[model samples]
Target: MPTGNTVSDGVGAFQSREQIILKDKKQLDCENAQDDDNDGHYKATHPTSYMDTMLHLFRGNIGSGLLAMGDAFRNGGIIFAPIMTAVLGVICVHAQHILLNCSEEMYRETKRPKPPGFADTVSLVFAHGPVKLRFLAPTMRAVVNAFLCITQLGFCCIYIVFIANNVKMIADQYGITIDLSIHMIFVIIPVLISCMIRNLKFLTPLSMIANVMMAVGVGVVLYEAAQDLPSIQERTFLASWQQLPLYFGTAIYAFEGIGLVLPLKNEMRKPELFQKPLGVLNVGMAVVGCIFISMGFLGYLKWGEDVAGSMTLNLPRGQILSSVVQALIALAMLFTYPLQFYVPMSITWPGLRKRFGPKALVAKELGYRAIMVMLTFVLAQSIPELGLFISIVGAVSSTTLALMFPPIIQLVHEGHRNRLTKYIVIKDCLILLLGALVFTTGTYESLSAIIKFFRKES
Candidate 1:
């Protein structure tokens, strides 16, 4: 297998086609080395199984966003809710396929194996493109890294808001009226502690616990929602067209799991299974889309125009079941905060470590993580509109990462002259237009909603 030294040498000799092709066998060795080391986290012999990959994707996709689908449905109505959910699901899966295909082509041409992260993939794609485009490669990498950082930090902020809002709800039930910022401060300590964990594998048990809690909470929510289903005549069949932006934002946010796709695929023992017709990515996302559709339809049908930012908040308070569901969700978010925090930390630490030197690597990483958690807390407190914040981040950051980048990457990878390329280019261009529409309109609506909410509060 190719050692660390060979991998470094292969990347350095990226401009040499002859060298790369000659080193194809050695690059295969690098893949075997990566599989053995499992990205330096898992033991070489115990790589992730296909089932584990599916479960991880499912878990990653079904987080705080699932709880907001009911609110999204309230904006779009029953007619648009299920339809939009399915459409967004298909779009998300297609983008993931684009990334996978591009990565595979890059491997075949360069014999360098696939990049482990999104930013790396972007860098590699541009670096291997035409001579004129090579100079922009570093800039493209920076942009991807910036979006990844923003997307992950956005998730951390959402977790803080989610935890604070739920805790405030529970506290108000006991006649304790604490400020939301105070509740936010209360949650930050545990998040700070959790962020100190530097390894992803160490959090596997916590991830499993989070999955179970979320499953139970969602079940209770569905049961409560079903208990008070309104008649068909009482429900609106269609929402105003202006509200479509909000629906777009929320649906994209809820279904955007594109960030997790590459990482999971790269780690899989049977990496080839990730992109098949009925493979892990498609199956996992199908399940997630179904859950969102069901939750949004049933929850909106039950609560009509009164569904809160999260359906859990719409549940009857002071009841044991409602309290349990809320608390469980908070716990789930607490566990999830660290997982989300890890991504940005991983991205940021290398630069910091280079400056600070290797001796203080652990200290610098932990310190950086703690500061990031605090920053998220501060951001959460500033714009405490949980649903609107989610929509804004989804529109601006998640949509860019999940919807925009994949098509652009594919277009760049496949030049625009061939007959076969015509159809592919047309499809990708349409997807780009859709992403731009969502980013512009959804961002406006989300920001407008936040402004109106705060104006009323003030």
Candidate 2:
């Protein structure tokens, strides 16, 4: 009887263990199915087509910076401006390629999802890199995030100055005197409301409207500029060599779309097509470079050292059409403020959320954005030098984000196996050197110019 009881107990235990295993398996399967559904929902709602990706790239790059290209040409002159534009274009494209290649290789090796942004890429590189460097991965991620936040905020500051200057110019033309700071204040509420939006995909309609306004504004400005083209013989082919640093700052600022590249790629309906030969990036950047070159060359040729900080500002004040263009461009940038602010908010909000907890997330986020807008408004009021501010930010933040990080990440990812040829390594080193040079020199030049301007104003 005892032997029979022992057999029966063993059988009951085995059956219980099997039941537990089956329950666990079902739970796991359900969780996986839920994850798959979430991913599918995301793709369904946010999938961007090839052309849409191209448009987003263009929209991001060809902002207020494009209007400043003519001023950039004033520093580099005709010959150097076009040449440097092309060179920078190629360098920007190559740097993007390096980033994408490294991302793909890392994804393959780790069998993980590729990084989705510039900061994420930096963190991934350091995390999966040499054993010694793995410890610094979190710090490096913070650094990249800091740079991105600063860059986007810098953009906000520039937009404020841009809007203020243009609006003040129009107000003055009508014999209405209002401080630029007041104009800056006028747009704050609108910008703050726009920043309340949490999802980037939802901003697509606003982006499209802004793009149209910008296109129309550019057309009007170009038409106005072309009507009074100065003699080619009269214009200088080369500028003072000392001014080259300023040119580097401005042109680099114009092409600083590297931050947007990966995000655009990650959101695409068919991401693989983004990296193909003659793909979205290449085509989009090519068009962007052409637009910059043409605008700078033609505007400078027409104005011949008389162009203002923005091409729109240089438009005839007496013309109603010029006023209309200014307003349109201002509106375009007004809409773009949120798009630019999105990166900084995404980076900074998580920390804020952690501190405040999930229950108050929306309130905290909106409050944070409002504070950011007010801060930018105050800075714009203080400095009020749109061109100089743009150059300084581009030199300090854009150079690091666009030119410095990519090659370093590539080297780290490739390791010591010399997977990259010696020639490639040498080339990357050269690029790094160039970035460092631009950052140091351009920063100094921009700061000096700003200080002098402020002193004069005082």
Top model number, TM-score: 1
Model 1 misses residue 396 by how many Å? 0.6
Clashing pairs in 2: none
lDDT digits (tens) for residues 38-61 of candidate 1: 343323244478787766666666
Candidate 1 residue 304 C-alpha distance from true site, Å: 1.7
- Compared with the true structure, what per-residue lDDT tens digits does model 2 show for residues 194-248? 8888876676567567667878998888788788676888877888866788888
Single out the weakest 10-residue window by summed lDDT for candidate 2: 1-10
